[model samples]
Target: MSHAIAADQREHRRLQLAPTIIRADIEQDGKSREGYLINVSLGGAFLSIADPPAKDTTTTDLHMLLPWGIGECHVQARTVWEQTDDQERAIGAGISFIDLSEDASNQLQSYLDRFKELSIEITS
Candidate 1:
């Protein structure tokens, strides 16, 4: 599906997030899972990861290293949706931000703006 349509469906702003994959350790179970993030809005983020919190687990906490070398941001997120393959392996997940720092939010917005500019350049 096109990014725009997917974003629209999810009620998220469509932006080309230059994702940086990272290993995430959740506070709940102390389980280490790979998480993908680039630009995240208040609504949700499109994450490409191998393992994710199950549908039963509604909430998670993460220490994410965002762009701008601003250090890790302690983030609280809620799992909105998750999709897996027949192998029962997670392929992607959508997480809604429950809480975020002001600096982190600003950095995310900047990343989104840059992604938009890059997309426009490519399409035009």
Candidate 2:
């Protein structure tokens, strides 16, 4: 399926963040490892990891290091899907937000809104 179609079918829209290294802390199986946020939305984010865990877990704790002074935002997420490379190696994971606090939700929404506004201005 095309990217646009998938996005349309999703519960919450995703924003393809600019090429910036946004660090993330993915904690699973009582361990914490570093990852990168590939895309983000109100629901969850797609993460890029160099070395993903061999064992797949249902849920994880993610801490996003937002830029522009947005700082770190924490959320509980579940691994809903995965993306593999041509060799059938898991390169990225697609997650769904489980429990989102009101403050974190607001902060994420505001950050996304700013980017959306910028994109609109650039296009128009």
Candidate 3:
């Protein structure tokens, strides 16, 4: 596949996830907590954290469940943006993956492909 397609396949888009479907144990700045993964791609994932969003430029270790029973993926990532509620209360954050492995990339791609197919099926 071309490099561009790889990047697009893992683009950080939003997807509403069922609770406990993909659990994420987030470790950052020496603190450890847990969050549910809202959406995930090769590039990054948007995590719906119950705790307050971390500070800017935070590097996080994301341990999560991949789609379609592909298995769990543990990758390092950095916070790029944040999502807040109407009251500006800290809600969730969008993270960009730092370095990903080839195996992990393929697994993520497969997971994404499954989602794409499911979306089409739902629409059709």
Best by lDDT: 2
Candidate 1 clash figure, as a count: 0
How much is the lDDT of residue 61 in candidate 1?
75
- Clashing pairs for model 1 are none
Off by over 4 Å in 1: 1-27, 38-40, 67-73, 87-90
Which residue pairs of candidate 2 clash?
Answer: none
lDDT of 1 by residue, 14-44 (tens): 4445544544445556655657753365455
**Model 3 segments more than 4 A misplaced:** 1-21, 52-55, 84-90
**What is the overall TM-score of model 3 with all chains considered together?**
0.70
- Arranged by lDDT with the best first, the candidates are 2, 3, 1
**lDDT tens digits, residues 3-105, model 3?**
9856755543443222223678888878899987656666766777875455466568878777577998888877667777747654888777777888777
Error of 2 at 35 (Å): 1.0
Each model's C-alpha lDDT?
0.62, 0.72, 0.70
TM-score of each: 0.61, 0.73, 0.70
Model 2, C-alpha of 33: deviation from truth (Å): 1.1
